[model samples]
Target: MPQRLELAPPAFNRRKILIHTAAAGALAAGVGVPRWARAQSGPMRIVVGYPPGGGTDRAARLVADRLQQLLKRTVIVENRVGAGGRLAAQQLVNTPPDQTVLLLANPAVMSVSPLIYKDLKYDVQKDYVPVAAVTDYDFGVAVGSALPVKEVQHMLAWIRANPTKANAGVPGTGSLPHFFSLMLSYMAQVNIEVVGYRGSAPLITDLIGGQIPLAFDTLDSLLPQHEGGKLRILATSGLKRSPFSPTVPTFKEQGLPLSAVGWNTFFAPSTTPRATVELLSKAVFQIMSEPETRAKFTAAKMVPVAMTQAQTEASFKAFNTQWTPVIRRSGFKPES
Candidate 1:
């Protein structure tokens, strides 16, 4: 079991008062403050692994805004983009456990990358503590105007018929979309090739320009075009239809027997105090439960679901168990 930090009500109240008093005095004196002291006085940071404007970054900013209001402390989002989010994960591992630094991480940084990368810098299970799961999203299998098929069945048939044009677009190599597409090919018994792009925006741009026939990306990334009639989403990688797009069917509904749900979760250094983890987790749960917050996430085609700390850890482990073998069997190796 994870360690739990408990404090007496009276002692906690007294400590809070003392800390605030000391912080005020320190500011008045204008003396140089230590990092640990500044942690208690400075604005907290929520690190994002992707560039601004992406779903992950947007989600982090949303939570940061709310968390600042709830905690009565300034919270900022810092983007440490690169290495498919591994850079941010590594930074979090090296960060001090002062309750001021947190990370909004994707499953790839926590579960998939460790299994695939030969020299992963950190062990997620050891270096980080799961605070709360913010939101969940499913990938959508979409087609450009260049493709004749309008649905998953038709798309599969088309792929089988035109083996030479069986290329599928993904955000990047070794990404969840890549693995999910490979799983689809394995189960559907087709020879669909994957064409990886640096990110989803370029892939979607090419798809719209008829440069790519098929692409798989977060529902949020493709929903606008799908709704605008510029693209057709055949199926989503969810157990059920997405709330944002109820008319769209899931892969399971289309007889694909696959469900790949990705989530953005909050994490702190593993050495963080248990009390701090519990406090932040409670705040996150409250933030996610807000009707306005839920609406915003749904607008972005993400489902707002908050899990307890224990539940979050279990979910992480379950995802690792489910995907590690599938990724290994796919026999994909990243370029060194």
Candidate 2:
């Protein structure tokens, strides 16, 4: 019989062909790319504007801890507290994009501060890129022991009756809380005397300890005192009641439909690579969606408001646009 012939994958020639094909695919992906790319290789830093133990600092730390493990890198939160978180924010802009420097800041740092500080060194929108919004710092209107008001309805009535006794403490001279207290008064048709303190910490301490009769403060910062029975929650600043504390109704529930409070978000230097920005955003959404992250935020009384990149950008622009008129109306004159 004639010699039988069989066909199979080529021994050495076929192996080279396979290798070349794989290399081609990887080239389409990126250089140094494996079938499954490893995480970024470097120590990472998340910069926070405030000192440790405060709500903003605490929130930033929470994210840093989970993200360090998620990205398989060393993540440290550097406390750059000063000028109401301005120093930390400015630092992010100046840092090299490749360093992975990020600002885990609240909305005030992004929105309100610039309006008040006439020559703010940094323009949050122009200087920084939006990473991912963590959540809103939900607030509540509560009276201290020094005041004789408890329920939202009673507080409204008292404000109308004793206009002079309606002095309330806000975070600072031109803070969101300041405008918020003013807006609340406008909606309630009452004259509210706003008193400014250095920061939310002192304002909150006074409110609970009865030095100030009323205040508008972050829910995360105020929940502990409310739970400790040091203050009485008159109304939550949310449009609707929070599931965390169902007993305390929302402002709308008390017939104050104007929703005014503070919020927080994450940002990166505008110069950061798009790949890095997208990577950070993807990580943020994943972390926020995690069960443990949700649980921690819920316990802290933070109300999450997830936004797509486009949406957050539009929102930032809208906030910047709208807040100008609002600031002018609030009797704020930016220093010359």
Candidate 3:
């Protein structure tokens, strides 16, 4: 059983004591006490699967800072970086259902890892419950200045014209960008090679230096360079244009049958009580709905989109269903 804190003491007297006793009896019968009435009080943690400074980490910190104010508890962000977020996810799975710990995760860890990893320790569906949807970001395809292509059609044509220089850089192997690149090639009828890097820094470094002609990564990471003319954004991997780069067209608009939108979401251990989940979900929705919060995320190149708990679960289910087939078709296998 989870520990509970007494918020206040009842006044000592026969009449007051009778009222307190009656209230206790009702709570014991599971009648009138609200779910949050038993909420645990302590320092809360928001775990990030990746190291600090990445988009997910930044978002986690942003939420943690606001959550502290909303919940009136000390909220901390913990980084358990490894295995592409699997390590941090497993940690959350093993934690007690006290609702004091949550994982700030992305689709890469929740939806993609299950499809790719053969020896994952925790089951995403069975071990975790969706709490809230945080932010949605689209991937952008950019070409270095050295590359002559300025649009999707031009880039595809350039790939056909110069087959040897048709390789694209992805931030990591088996990542959304990696598979999106594969889908792009499949749809465009072009054979562009994929080269995976440790993270976006090195990938963007080589991209600007002409080491790689094309790169695919989150719009947040690539939009700055695109604005500075260091590179050209051909298309974004969203059904609609990104608010941060509204001038850029989506792959679908550019005639490619591909769209990849990723999100940052909150999750708690599956065993957590429904009331606890609802409490946290409502808190997150309130935080994300604030105009200041929305502006902060927007300035960070992330779109703030809050969803109800049911909607969050439905979105996760829909995303998982949509990506499973795509992952299988990619024929990607993790290294032992």
Give the alpha carbon lDDT tens digit for every residue of 33-124 in model 3.
Answer: 34453456667889998889887898998889987776767888999999878899987776776557888899888988888888899999
What would the per-residue lDDT of candidate 2 be over residues 1-336, giving only the tens digit for each residue? 112212111112211222233234323222222222234556778888888887677778888887776666688888988977888887777667557777887666887777677778998767898777666655678788888776777887887788767789987777776776766665566777888887778988988777878987666556777888888877877555656677888887877665544556788898887777766666665666565776787676565444445544655564455445556557675343
Extract clashing residue pairs from model 2: none
Query: Which sections of candidate 1 miss by over 4 Å?
Result: 1-39
Minimum summed lDDT over a 10-residue window in model 1 is located at 5-14
Ranked candidates, highest TM-score first = 3, 1, 2
Candidate 2 — which residues are off by over 4 angstroms?
Answer: 1-41, 199-211, 300-306, 318-324, 333-336
Per-candidate clash tally: 0, 0, 0
Native-to-model Cα distance after best TM-score fit, residue 264 in candidate 2, in Å: 2.2
Best by TM-score: 3
Q: How close is candidate 1 to the true structure, as a TM-score?
A: 0.82
What does candidate 2 score on TM? Answer: 0.79
TM per model? 0.82, 0.79, 0.84
| Runs in model 3 lying further than 4 Å from the true structure | 1-39
Error of 1 at 255 (Å): 2.0
- The CA lDDT at 92 in model 2 is 73
